[model samples]
Target: MTLATAAHAPEGGTTAPAVRIRDLTVVYKTPAGELPAVSEIDMDLPAGTITGLVGESGSGKSTLALSLLNAVQPPGRISSGTVEIDGLGDVVPLQGDKLRRVRGGQIGYVFQAAQNSLNPLKTVGKQLLDLGRSHDVDDLRALVSEAKELLGRMGLDGARVLDSYQHELSGGMRQRVGIMLALVLNAHVVVLDEPTTALDMITQANILEIIRNIHAERGLTTLVITHDIGVVAEVADQLAVMYGGRIVERGPVRSVLGEPRHPYTQGLIRAIPRLTGDIDQARALPGRPPTLGTIPERGCVFRDRCELRMSVCDTVEPVLERHADQLVACHAVAGQEPDGGAPTDDGQEQT
Candidate 1:
């Protein structure tokens, strides 16, 4: 499943998508009712770069990742949308074997917690060799040796580590194996869901660099789902800010992280604990985001939390609108301000 093998994959005669999704909606069919996890999300990630999806815990960032693999983890399912893979073919309402094929063959995932993800009973080398064998890779001896070299590249013993169990390796080392497995299969795209969250800052930096290098050298597309602004700053070319199951802002990473068109986006950046902030003067957002299970049906879901909420926000669900180079889904940000008298960020009437 290494990148070298991905290059020669049966063309299936079409182009490659790396991953393309549109109008994707995932909803959990709750006993009480339904909880929308992701709504009307549209995203396109091509080959050779990483797109970062940033948001708080319930912001549905991880849900979007699982949707790609059709591994919606129950109580949840993709309600609608199209998920297409470029080189093989389109798999919109993909299901059964079609979805399974798309997952391992073209897409791979690095789970958030590698320690728990690795099989406790199996040795690391056995796992790698087995995966290679399943993919019909011919070189058993060479692949087994390569696993060691790969571990070495990540600062571990190729052979010694191979015979070790998941619990035996350090946190950082387990994560390294998780990453290697994702790329070793030469997956066209790797969905890294908070993959570095468990590592220390130093280790996190190293992992991100590894991912960056892999993308550049292998032309692999990556989708990094995280909430850490620093992580997005380091690896993302595109950034999507999620709130209440919707993408509130998305565009060039620089613009979204720097200028930050939406108030929510701004508040998030302002709340980051910067070293430059007064030692005791860390910033904070005023309120909480909406709960996915019981969100208000109408109006902006962020209204209760938004510093710039207007009366109109109580009734209107804002549509995604283009502003400058970014897509912002906010009535105020889209300039459909309420009462022609919506309060500004400073709580003053517009001139």
Candidate 2:
């Protein structure tokens, strides 16, 4: 489906958003000082749709996704903001059984290294059936049946691999099994962190197609964290662009992909490989994103790498402002296009 069609808010929809995160900040207290891995990111992940969080490594994409699952890596803690699940609201501040139920039942996560998520000692079938047994599966036979079906759907040998251990499966197969595990939860939201990163291009595409199909069929709200723009274009209805530790651009994928507002977003679009002869016309922003800890307090985080950097950028922080359908944080983009929309290359305007 087209992005515009998929980004639709329901007509008085009954479900609270699958996930609503506001001003979410994941930080750490270090010998140097307080450090922020992910800062000031706000987005509403509606049910049954995919929202792509795109950024470079160390840009805090993974940190943000992990925070949603309450699974942030070592030394990282959520310093502020709220994470509200569809049925269980305010996940961050919650503790104990309520948090457990909300996370494991309402949220399913697929990691980049699917192999790592599974147990090498157990049969794949056991791992896949674990979730189902907790909620709906009444007996061994029932859980096995569901596991088999899920495996088959992912193009794996469901019946055969059911008895096999993790060491027996290929990398791609292991990843598929990881996806199957998440599916068995019947989760309201599925968080995929570069699920296809370990595969070849063809495998990546196949996985992407499967994810899209699953989301559409189940009306599953999905949070996909990836370094690839192509992946985002294929599956995302909504986009959240990040840099350093913050969201710099967010909107319908069509606009953010077509005409980006932040320099970082513009740089990202330019970096994607083009098949339609426009590859050379694409822009590439120079330099890497700044590291999180011990960072300079003054100026925009992207100033050193921004082609449009100004003297004022060194002394001020930009706030995300609404422009038409998108939200952008940039000093250069502000007010120039008063309509709050991106400028078309050919002098055309869209609102």
Candidate 3:
């Protein structure tokens, strides 16, 4: 289905959002001081749909996703914010057994690297059974049946896959099995971190198809975190654009991709290579993303590289405000477009 069509909210037309996050902030405590990874973000993940969170490295996309699982480790901590799951109360403050119960049971997570998640020395069956045992499924036959069933959903031979070790399977197969593991606990929400990274084009397509099918058939809410715009274009119903530890733009995938309001969002869309368009016309966003420690204390984070920047951008930070259909955080886009001529050959507008 098309993005616009798939993104139309309402499975039964009465279900509340699956997840709600408000004023969320994650900080990493360092010797120098505190550095914010995710800063005061507000977002809603609708039930039974895929939401794509897109940004470059260090943009806090993965950190934000992990926070949902209370998986942020070490120096990284959820300093502030409330993450409310549908039936469960605020998950932000959950600790020990409560937190452990929620993770891998209520909300499943597929990490970026499948091999790293698996034990090299153990057979996949042992690991799968271990997870089952944690959740109190002691029957070996039942656990094996469940493992085979989940693998079958992904079109894999469950028995064969269970007998093999991590090194025995291909990268794509391992990734699919990772996803299956997340579902083994019958979690309501699934979070996939760069699920398609490091896969061949054909493999990527197959994985995406599996994700889409699971979402449709199981009615599970999904959050896909990735830097690939192409993956979002193919799988996401809603899209959120992040920059410098904040969500700069958010709306339906069709609306955001087709008529992006924020300049950063626009640049990301333009950077995608189109088969029918002029190859050389594609341009990368100038300037590197800001480091977490180096993020400016005030003003718009993207002001330095933004072609539409005005004097106001130097002094005033932009809050996410409603534009036409999407919410965008940009002082320049909040009012008038900074008067400059159309884009030039060099990818910058003429003053």
Q: Best candidate, TM-score-wise?
A: 3
> Across residues 129-178, which tens digit of lDDT does each residue of candidate 1 receive?
87787677788787777667667877777788888998888878888888
Each prediction's whole-model lDDT (CA): 0.76, 0.77, 0.84
Clashing pairs in 3: none
Separate clash counts for every candidate: 13, 4, 0
TM-score of 3: 0.91
Residue 228's lDDT within candidate 2 is 88
Better of 1 and 2 by TM-score: 2
Estimated TM-score for each candidate: 0.87, 0.88, 0.91
Could you tell me how far off, in angstroms, the CA of residue 256 lies in candidate 2 after the best superposition? Answer: 0.7
Q: Top model by lDDT, which number?
A: 3
Please give the distance, in angstroms, between residue 81's alpha carbon in candidate 1 and its true position after superposition: 0.7
lDDT of 3 at 58: 96
- Compose the digit string of candidate 2's lDDT tens values, residues 56-132: 99888999998898777667889888887867777887777666665657788887954487787888777656655
- Residue range with the least summed lDDT across 10 consecutive positions in model 2: 342-351
TM-score of 2: 0.88
